[model samples]
Target: MILAVDIGTSSMKGGLITKEGYLFSYHRVRFPLESLKGDFSFSTELWSQGFLEILETLGASKVSVVAISGNGPTMVAANAQGKPLSPALMWNSDLGDSSIHSSSYYLSKINWLRENEPQLYEKSDLFLSCPEILYTQLTGRSVMVAPQEGYIPYIWSDSELERFHFRKSAFPEIVHMGSVVAPVSENAFLKTSLKPGIPVVACGSDFIASLIGSGAMKPGRICDRAGTSEGINYCASAAIGDSRVRELPHAVKGLVNISAILSSTGSLFEWYRQLTGQEKNNYKETMDGVNAVPASQGHPFFFPSMKGENLWEFKKGLFSGLEPGQGKFELGRSVMEAIGFAVRRSLEIFEELDLPVHELRVSGGQAKSPVWNQMKADITGKTMLIPEIEDAELLGCACLAATALGIYNSVSEASEDLVKIKHEIHPRKEFSDIYDIKYRRYRRACESVVSFYRDYPVSE
Candidate 1:
């Protein structure tokens, strides 16, 4: 059996998969994020504890392999021994930005790093995402960041190591995604009540894994990942040479993945919940109320830039179109509509790149809401499909591990063997027309706000 784990910003998920791609057992646990004046952070100890606890629950009987996937671009300062030097700077953490001008500005931030953290940056032997770091601590071996696990130590040729200014000794020997890292350490087994020598593989990033899990491997396919933030990722054989479209590192060689992310989605809803104190049985109840409201037609258009707009230089969040008599439901619907419209804007850019969007695979916590999924489908004018397994990220990691262990010939083959589509949500012509109008308004609001900021800057 192979163990697959997804370590996300808010939670950690684990699953036990058979060699044939069937999942046998699964577990999940939530962890808190520490927010201090908008600088988000997570305790490394908390992460470690969550993993250990999950392993203890799995009890190590039927598990033979382990694979890991995690949130990306999360910066961690690790010591020479591969231990964390400080709390993980989460992907959402804005504290690392050197200045307000640097926030949400990727190139400027990179330049800032070169100037400010030059020494630490130069000595940065290994700059890995959360999953890589976690796997390193578990296995006591180094693996170069690559798509396939088999290509690890051999792929990181001496030249490649030097190019990254990394020492051969400091780098972890690469193990394929399903390859066994080591016998669970004797000490670890004793503490966690698990047998040792379980094979651990290098699963890729959470988004990539989720896409695979959602069965969105073919070109022209798209997946809308609506979590705290919304990320619209589509598979394309051709490269999109736009700064807005982030070209993600692929586990597979010679293949590229492109994504356009809207930094706020469900987060806006959460903010509304906090402000209104609307009591609901759960997220479903909250969304049902939102679904009852009509498509908004008024001022108070939200910028949906809670984390700053990804494709622009703006850094501040904005809200417009506030008026009396606007109840919580309108406010909630507007936030939902704003997010859907943001996604529509991203699709417009994708269309401009001439990328074909054949279908959209929707997943994540927010996908549970028919309202949100329908809203997204209407706004993008594409059919949205949900997979039988909602936790595509976890399944994607497992599939990678299975392929790495030679259980499957390739990642695509494994994805086909495992992932199953559960439902389809098609766009309604009427709703699509409504969304067209709202989307135009959304753009106008965005442009107007950006113009206002440019002409009349806000005091920092």
Candidate 2:
């Protein structure tokens, strides 16, 4: 059995998986709200606590190897003994124009630390990503897991580090995904009660792991990992250059991943629930509320995101074309429809780039809703495939561990053998036609808003 764990944006999730890919047990621990304050960063100690609690809850007696994946480019500055010296600069953190290497997000954070907090930067021995820090805690080794050599520029290269005047010693040695980082150390054993000599395998960013876990290894397949934020990642043969989307190296050796991060998707739903005082409502109740209104019902056009694809400028969340008779059911349906439209806009970009997006392998919090699933399919005019395990990151970690332990020859092979789709939601022609017209209007509204913002700048 493999003890697969993922440190997510809001929580830490762990699962016990067999070589065959069956999820036997699962546990989750959400980070305290108090820890998440200021500039969208959090203390790395939350991860430390989350790991210990998850280990105790899962009780990994039969676990042979541990594999970890985490949300990143979250950078953590730590000492030689793996103790974090400062709060982790999270993936979404905005440090304006501080980067010497403008193209690399990870390097920008390092540069920000060096420029703003010289003492802390000078004291730090290693600058690691989220997963590397956790893996370091488990194995007493610090290493960066690069997906491939193609990703070196996006992360860091020796020349780029020199050009940016970053000390190479501050960065850990880069290793490939699925490589053994180190054994669970004696100190880790004393802290968490895990047996020594168990190899800790390195997995890539949570987005890559989710793609692997969703079995979207082949070109043309898209992995729509929807959680607090959403990542619509399209696997492709080569990188696409676009200002609207980012193209990064895929977990598979030669292929690339063209992705657009929807900064907020599932969080939009949560925000609606909270604002409307529907926090106590269960999933069924929430879904029921959204479902009460049929697809044909008239509702206001909702732009869910407060900020558009251009993360620098703030965008308005508008409820345009609202009718006097409309109520919460109409509003609820529109909120979900807005999410679907946001996803569709992203897919339209892939379409414009002539990338094949036959279907979306959907995973995360939003996958559980049948209405939302079908709505997404209808809006995007693509199929939605829900895997048996919606938390693909955990399963992806298991695939890495299985491959590392020689249970499978490759991560791709393990992913193929392990991933099982439980449901396939196809687009309904009637709803697709309606959504097609609505999407056009939505795009127009978005363009108008962007034009307005461009003309009358909001002072920062």
Those runs of model 2 whose alpha carbons end farther than 4 Å from true positions after fitting are: 37-41, 96-99, 305-314, 323-327, 451-460
Best model number under TM-score: 2
Measured by C-alpha RMSD in angstroms, how accurate is candidate 2?
2.5
* Candidate 2 total steric clashes: 0
lDDT of 1 by residue, 36-124 (tens): 12233467666667777777777567777777888765656555445765556566766454432321222222333446666655665
lDDT of 1 at 384: 82
Any runs in candidate 1 off by more than 4 Å, and if so which?
A: 18-25, 35-41, 56-59, 78-83, 94-128, 148-169, 174-179, 278-281, 296-300, 306-315
Q: What's the lDDT for all of these models?
A: 0.67, 0.83
**lDDT for each residue of candidate 2 in 239-280, tens digit (9 for 90 to 100):** 878888987888888998889877767666766787777867
